[model samples]
Target: MNPKNWQLSFFRREQRSLFGEILDWMLTPLLLLWPVSLALTWLVAQGLANKPFDRALIYNAQALAQLVKLSPDQQRVQFNLPQPASELLRADDADLVYYQVIGPKGEILGGDRDLPQPQEDEKLGSYEVKIRDDEMRSLEVRVAYTWVQLASDKSPVGMGPVLVQVAETREKRSVLATEIIKGVMLPQFAILPLAVLLVWLALVRGIKPLSELEERIRARKSDDLSPLDEKAVPLEVAPLVSSVNDLLGRLKDSIATQKRFLADAAHQLKTPLAGLRMQADLAQRKDASEEELKHSLKQIGRASVQATHTVNQLLSLARAEGGGAIDLQSCDMEALVSEVLHDSLPRAMDKGLDLGYDGVDTDSKRRFLKVQGNPTLLKEMIRNLVDNAIHYTPSTEERIGVITVRLLVDPYSQALAVQVEDNGPGIAAAERERIFEPFYRALGSNVDGSGLGLPIVREIAQRHGATVSVDVAHPGQTPPGACFTIRFARASNKFKTNMASGSADL
Candidate 1:
C-alpha cells in the first residue's frame, strides 16, 4: 500500500482501418508491376512480328539478283523482267513493295529508279542477301540488298559491281504486333480487378474473429469482470488478451479491498459514536446531581476523544492504501526512531510505562544508520510502531511496563533494523501475522485502540521494501512481551569500524 496518487492519462489517437492497411500492403506491388509487364510484352511481340516478314524481304532480293545476266551485245549488265513478274512483285493490299538494281557502271539496270540506295560504307556480297531498315517516301520500311557479279570469269573493263535492293512498307508487321499484344494483355486487364476483389475478401475473413471479440466484450455487463479466454484469440493477439486479463484481476482485488476497508471503518467507529451520544444524553438529564453531571461530562469527553482518534486512524490507513511516485533518499533511520520515541514519551509517562531509546550513536555512525526510503513515510512507520508499543503494554506503579525503541546495524552488510520491544502481554504465534490486518485487535487486550497502528507500520514498511516481523521480547518470562522489527535493505556506503552505541531512559 503506497501513499500517493496512481492515476494514468491516455492520449487519444487518430483511428485507422486495419483492413484497408493490410489490403494496401498486399496489392500495391502487384498494381505497380502491371504497367511494367505490359511494356515488356509489347517489345517481345514486335520482335516476333518482324522475323518472318524480314525473311520474305531477303527472298525477294535474291530473286531480283538472279535476273541479272549479260546483255545480248554482252557489253554491260542488263535487266529483263516479264510484265507478269513485275506486276506480281508490286501486287499487295496492305503494303507496297519496291526493288532496284544499279549496273556496274552506276546505270539503272531494272526495276523502280526511286528506291533508296544502301549507305556507301555498306559491305557488298555477290548474290548474298543482307537486310536493313531505311525510309522511302517518308514512310518506314524494311530493305534487303545485295551486290551481283555479272560474270564470274570477268566483267567489262570499266565495270565494277551491281547492287540489288528490295524494301516493303511496315503496315503488315504492325498489324501482327497489335494482334499479339491483345492476345497477351487483354486477359491481364480482366484478372487485375478479380485479384483485388479476392484480396478484399481474404482481409475481411482474416479479421472477422477480432470483430467478434469486440462484440463479445461490448455485450458484457459493467459488473462482469471475468477474464477473456486467451486460447480463443489468434496466437499473435494472445499476449494482448492476457495483459487485459491481468489488469482485470488487479482491479477486482482493489475493489474488494476498498469494500472491506469501508465496512471495517464503519463497524469500528459505531461504538464510540454511540457512547458519545449516551454520555451527552446523561449530562442533560433533568434530575442529575452535580457529581453525576461531572461524571457524565467526563465520560462524554472520553468518548469524543476516542471518536476523534478513530477518525484520524481511519484517515491514516486510507492514505496508506493509495499510491504514487515516491522521492527516495538515504534517510537517518535511527534519528526517525529517536524522534518517535521522544514524541511518545508523554503518552508512556501518562500510562506509567518506561519508554527509552537505545542505539548506535548518530554522530559516530550516521552513514551506517541510513536507510533508503521516503522520509515522510519512514517517519510515519516509526511513529506507528512506537504508538503501538505504548498503547498495548500494560503499566502500573508497582511494576512499570518497559517499552524500548532500538536501532540495530548489521556490521557486515551495513543494513539497518528498527525494533520496538515491549515487556507486556505478548502476541500469540498463530495471530502474529493476523494482527497486521486493519481493525484486528488482540483477543484479551481490553484496550481502547484503533488497531490501525501495526497495519500502518506494515504498509509503510512494505512501501520502503522493508520486512516487518514479530517475536517474543524475552523468552520464558511471565510476561513474554512482543518485539516488532523492521529490516530495511542496506543503502549505505563503506562503514566505519568501532561504532559507538548510546541509550537513554525516559
Candidate 2:
C-alpha cells in the first residue's frame, strides 16, 4: 500500500467505533443548522425592529404635511412646524432627524434644502423608506417620504402636489435591531453547547447495553457456549444478540464434534498399533520357526490393513462433517445403487450371500430413482451401507445370507428411497440410534471392521437432505433381520412426481 493510504487503513481498522459513528451523524446536522438558525433569526429580528420605528417616521411626515396650505391668491404654498412637534421629532439623542416641504413646482419651502427629492411616480399616502448617501453632505441617511395633495384643486395653475420628506441618521435603528438580534441569539449560543452535551450523554446512555453485552461475553469461560440473554437487551439490539447466540450454538456443536472425532481416532489407532507391535515381537523371538514367523507376519499384515481402514474412515468422517456444502445436481440413485452392488458382489459371493439391486422399473425406460445430491458423496454413502451389510451378515449351512439393495419412489408422497436389507442379527432397539455415532458398533456382533461406516453414511445422508433409518425386516422372525433405508425428501426428489404414473418410456 502507499504510505498515506496504509496509514489511513490502519487508523480506520483500529478505531471502528459505533458510538463515534453515531455521534458524528447526530451532531453534524445540528452544527450545520446553527448557522442557518442564526440567519433566520437575524431576518426575523430585522423585521421586528423596523416595525414601530417605521410607523413613527411615517406619522411625523404626515403631521408635517398638515401645516402646508395654498397662499390666498393660490399662487404659492406656505408650511411651518410647531415647536412642540419639532421637539418631539428631535427627541432622540442617538439619532438626528431632518425634514423638507416642497411647493407645487418643486421649490423647497421649509427645513433642510439638501434633502433629496422624491421620485415623480412614488406612491402618495404611504411612506417609502430607503437608505442612500447624501453626496453633498458626505454622510449616509435613512429617508422616508410621501406626496400629499394638501389642496383640492385650489391651484388651476397645473402645478404638481407638494412633497414632504423625512431623513434620519441610522444609529438608533442599528442599535435596536442589534439588541433584538442579541436577545434572540445569545440564549442559543449557550444552549447550543448544552444541547450538544445532552446529545452526547444520550448517545452514551443509549449504547450502554452493548457495553454490558461485551462485558458479559468477556466474562464467560472459553468453553462456555451458552446463549446471551436477549430479553435483557433493548428491542433495537435483540436481533444482533440473537445472531450472536446462533453463532455460539454452531461453534459449540463444531467443537463437540472435533472432540469426539479426536477421541475415537485415538482409540481406533491404539488397538491396531498394539496388535501390530505384539505380532512383530512374536516374529522376532529366539526359537521361532519359519511357519510361526510367517503366521506372525500375516497377523501383522491384517493389523496393518485394519489400521489403514480406520484411518481412512476417520478422514472420510471428518470430510463429511467439516467440508463445505455439497454441490447438488441431478443424480441417478438407481445407477449409483447398481454400481455399489456390483462392486460388493465379489465379497457377497465369497461369503455365499445373495446380494443384488432391485431398482424399480430397472428394465423399463422410466426414470424413478433420481434425486439432487453430490454424486460422489452419495455413492460413498451407499457403498458404506452395502459394505456394512456385507461385513455383518453371516451365511448359514442351510440358507445363505440375503442382502438386497432396492430403490423406489412412493407415488402418493413423492418420496424417493434407497434401501439395503440383510437377513443378519438385527440391531437392538437400544443400539439403533447409537450405531450412527462414530466408532460405535452393535452389541454382541464380532464384526471385523472399523465402526466409522454408519456414521459416514449418516453424515453424507444429512448433507444430501436425506434421512437414514434402521428397522427390523423380519420382526419376531428367527434372525430378525435389519433393513437400513435412506429416504430423500420429496422437495429434493425431482423425479418422483414425473415417474409417479410408472409408465415405461418407448
Candidate 3:
C-alpha cells in the first residue's frame, strides 16, 4: 500500500474513535431538560392567573345572598336588588356576568336562572371554578354559593335555606392566564436557542485543540518520529499525547537498530566475497601447477563455507529480533546438550581436544533437569557455544586442549544453567561484553571462522529469557581458560511429571 493508505489503515486499527462519544455526552442532558422546564413553567402560570379573580367572584355572591327574604306567609322567597347593586355584576368589559337565586323548592327566582347546578354533595358557602355548558352557551366561570335564612326565623326555618350563586364568563380569566404563560415562556423561547447555540460553540471550541494537534501531526515528515509536546494539549488529553510520544520514541529506536544491522551485515559479507573472487582468478592462470590450482580451489571452498555460516547467523539474529509470541515447550537440556556435543565431536577430534559432558547423571535428578524454550533455537544456542569452544581452544604440537559441556541446575536458585568451558587462551575481562556484539572478535585471536557464533549464542539465550556471561575457568593459572555460561529464568513443569514416570518405570 501507499504511505497515505497505510497510515490510514494503521490509525483505524490502533486509535479509538473519540468524536461521537464526546458529542453524545455534551448534548443528551440539554435535550432531556428542555421539556421538563416547559412543563414546570406552565404549572406556575395556571396558579398565578387564578388568585385575584377567585376572591372577586366570592365577594359578589356574598352580597347577592344578603338581598334574600321570606314572604309573610313564609311559604315563598323574594329577592329585591336595587339598580346600582345589579349593575356592578356586569362591570367587567371583556366577560359577561351571571348569577342565580333559588327558593327552598329548587325554583329559579332571579338572574340567569339557567346556570349549571353544582353536584348534590357540594359543600355550602364554598367558591369553585369549572368549565361547563349553560342554556345560553358554553363558557368557563368561577362559582360561589351560600345559604341564607329569612328575617322571621320560626316559619322560614321550616321553609328551608335560600340559595344564591354568582358566575361569570371566563374571557377575563383566560386572557390573564394566557398573558402569564406568554410572559414566562416567551423569554425562554428566545433564550433557549441562544443557550443551545452558545453550548454548540463551546463544544466546538473545546475540540479545537484536537484539530490543532492533528494538523501538527499531519505537517510532519514521514521519517520524523519526534515526540509530541504534551504541554500544548489540554490536561484531560495530556495522557493520550504522552502515550503517542512514547510510541514514536520506540519506533525511532527500532528504525535506528534496523539501519545499523543492515550496515553491519554488508560489511561482514564483503571479505569472504573478495577472497572467493581472488582465489578463482588464481585457479584460472595458465602458469599455475596442478597442486597450486587444487590449493586455490580449497581456499575458495573454505571462503564459501565461512560466507554461508555468516548468512545463517544473520538469519538467526533477525528471527530473535522480530518480536512475537514464541512457544516455550519443555526442553531436555541434557538431551539438547548431547545432540550439540555429538555434532561438534568431529571438530573436537580434528583439533585433538578432549570433549565431554559434566553434571547430574542419576536418572531421577537428570529427568527433572529441563528448561523452557523453542527446541530449535535452544539447540542452535548450544551448538554455537560448543562450536566456539572447539574452534578457539588451541591444540599445538606441545599440548592437547580440552573443552567440557555441562548441564547443571543451581541448588539454591533453582535456575537451569548450560556451561561451555575451554582450557585455551581465555578472553580478557575488558572484551567480555563486546564479544557478544555482532561480528566482533576478540583481539589477537586468529581463529579461522566468522565472528557470529558467540553473538548468536548470546542472542538466542536472551530470547529464551536467559543470561549469557564469560568467566575464567582456571583463575591465576597460566593461560587461564574461558567459561561461557547461560542461566535460564525458570524450569519446566513437565520435567517433574517425566521424572515421576521414569521412577515408576524403573
Candidate 4:
C-alpha cells in the first residue's frame, strides 16, 4: 500500500466510534458520584456536630440545677444564676430563655408563667422542644429538667418536691454547629476541586501509553510490516496491538505472494509475446516470396490471436486472485445472451453451424433476468463458451453442429442459470474437471486452442459470485458434446421493486 493509502486507513480506524461512548459511560458515573459524596459528608458532619451541641446544653442545665437553694420557710425554692452566665445565655439571637421550679402538685414556683411543663412520667434528662415565637417562627428549643429532694425541716413550712427546668432556644447550638462544620468542611471544599483535577490529570496520564502507541503506528512507514513492540505497550492495550501486528504480518505475506505471481506471469508470457512480434515482423519483410509471405502471414495472425487470448486469460486470472479489479454492475442476463448470440451468429454462419438461444417470455413479456455483475466480464464468459462450442463441434454439409444457449431462472433458489450446450465431441468424465483449469487442454483435442477459454469463463463467473460446472448435455448415452452451466446470484424481488419504483440505478 502507498503512504497515502495507509494514512487514509489510519484515519478511518481513528474515526470516532464506540470508544468515546464507552469512556463517557465509564467516567460519567465517577464524576457524578462526587456530588453524592459531598452530600453524604455534609450529613455526617451535621450529625457529629449535633452531639457536641447537645452535650453543651446538658452541661448548662446541670450547672443551673446546682444553683438551686431552699427558702427560709422550707416551702419555696430560690435560684441564684450569676449575671455574667445569664447574660451569656441571653445573648443568643434565638428565643428568650425560660426556667421554672415546679412543686409536687405541678405548681409553677419561679419562672415564666406560660412555660409548658414536662410530661408527668417523662424521664429527667435533656430533650428537644418546639416553641412558637411572637413572630410565628417555630424555634427548636432544648430543655433540661431535674427533680430535687429538699431536706426535711420540722418547721411550720413542710418539705415538698421541687423541680428545676432550664430551657434555651437552639440558635446558639445551631451557630456552634455551623462553626464546627465550617472548620471541618472548608478544607474538604478546598481539596475536592483539586482532587477532581488531579483525577482528570491522572486519567490522561494513565492513557498516555495508548496515545504513544497510536503515534508510533502512525509514524511507521507504509511498507513496514514488522510487529509492534509489545513490551513497550500497556498491558490493557497489548491484545489490540498484537492483533494489529498479526494482521500486518498476513498482509505482508499476501503482498509478497501477489508480487511473486506477477513476476512469474511476466516471465511466462514474455517468450510467446516476443515470438508473435518477431513472426509478424518477418511476414511483413519485403524480401519474402508470395507463398512464403502468405504462410508466414497466416502463422503470424494465428500467433497474434493466441497471444492476445493468453494475455486476456492471464489478466482474468490476476483480477480473480486480486479480488475485484473489474468494476461490477447490474447486468441483464437475457439481454447479455441476446448480444452474445448476435455476435456469434456471424461466426456460426461462416462455419455452417447452427447456433440459437432457448427460453420463453411470460405472457409475451420479458421476464426478470437481471443479476448483479460486470456486463463486460459476463460477455467475455459467454463468448468463450460459445466460441469453444463452435470450434470443437464437428460440422459437415449434411449435419450441422448445433450450439444452444439456454437461460433458466430458478425462482425457488433465487438464482439465474445460463447453459451452453453443443453437439461436439463430448468430454470424458475424467477430463471435465481439469479442462476448467488454466493451460489444461484435454487429450486428443484436434482443435487449435490456447486452452484458456474455459479457465477465463470460470474465473469471470467466480468473480461474479457464480459457479461453473460441466455436465453431460444429453444423459443415458454418450452425449453429443459438452454443456457448460453457469449460475449467478439473481436479483431479489426487492431489487425489482426498487427498479420499478425508480429508486434503483440499474
* Best candidate according to TM-score: 2
**Where does candidate 4 stray beyond 4 Å?**
1-43, 58-268, 280-287, 290-298, 319-331, 361-368, 409-415, 474-479, 488-506
Q: How do the residues 54-107 of candidate 4 rate in per-residue lDDT, one tens digit apiece? A: 566566656766776677776566677778977786665654676666755666
User: Which has the higher TM-score value, candidate number 1 or candidate number 2?
Assistant: 2
Residue pairs clashing, model 4: none
Q: What tens-digit string does per-residue lDDT give for candidate 2 at 265-342? A: 899999999999999999999999999999999999999999999998898888788645678899988788777888
What order do you get sorting by lDDT, best first? 1, 2, 3, 4
Q: Residues 1-506, candidate 1, lDDT per residue (tens digit)? A: 33332222234455778887788889999998998999999999999999999998888889888888886767767778789989998998999999999987788988778888888888576788888898888999899999987653454443567899989999999999999999999999899999999888988899988998899899999988899999988998899999999988878867776786788789988998898889888888999889999998899889889888888877777667655457888787767776777788898889999998877654545467876778878888888888888888888877789988877675567666777888899999999999998888889889888888889888888878888888887778879988887777642333211111112111
Shift of residue 381 alpha carbon in model 4, Å: 2.6
TM-score result, candidate 2: 0.82
lDDT of 3: 0.77
Cα-based lDDT for every prediction: 0.81, 0.80, 0.77, 0.70
RMSD of each: 7.2, 4.8, 6.7, 10.3
Angstrom error of the Cα, residue 334, model 3: value is 4.9
Task: Choose 1 or 4, whichever is better by lDDT.
Answer: 1
Instruction: Estimate the TM-score of every prediction.
Output: 0.76, 0.82, 0.78, 0.61
**By the lDDT metric, which is better: model 3 or model 4?**
3
Q: Can you list the residue pairs that collide in candidate 3?
A: none
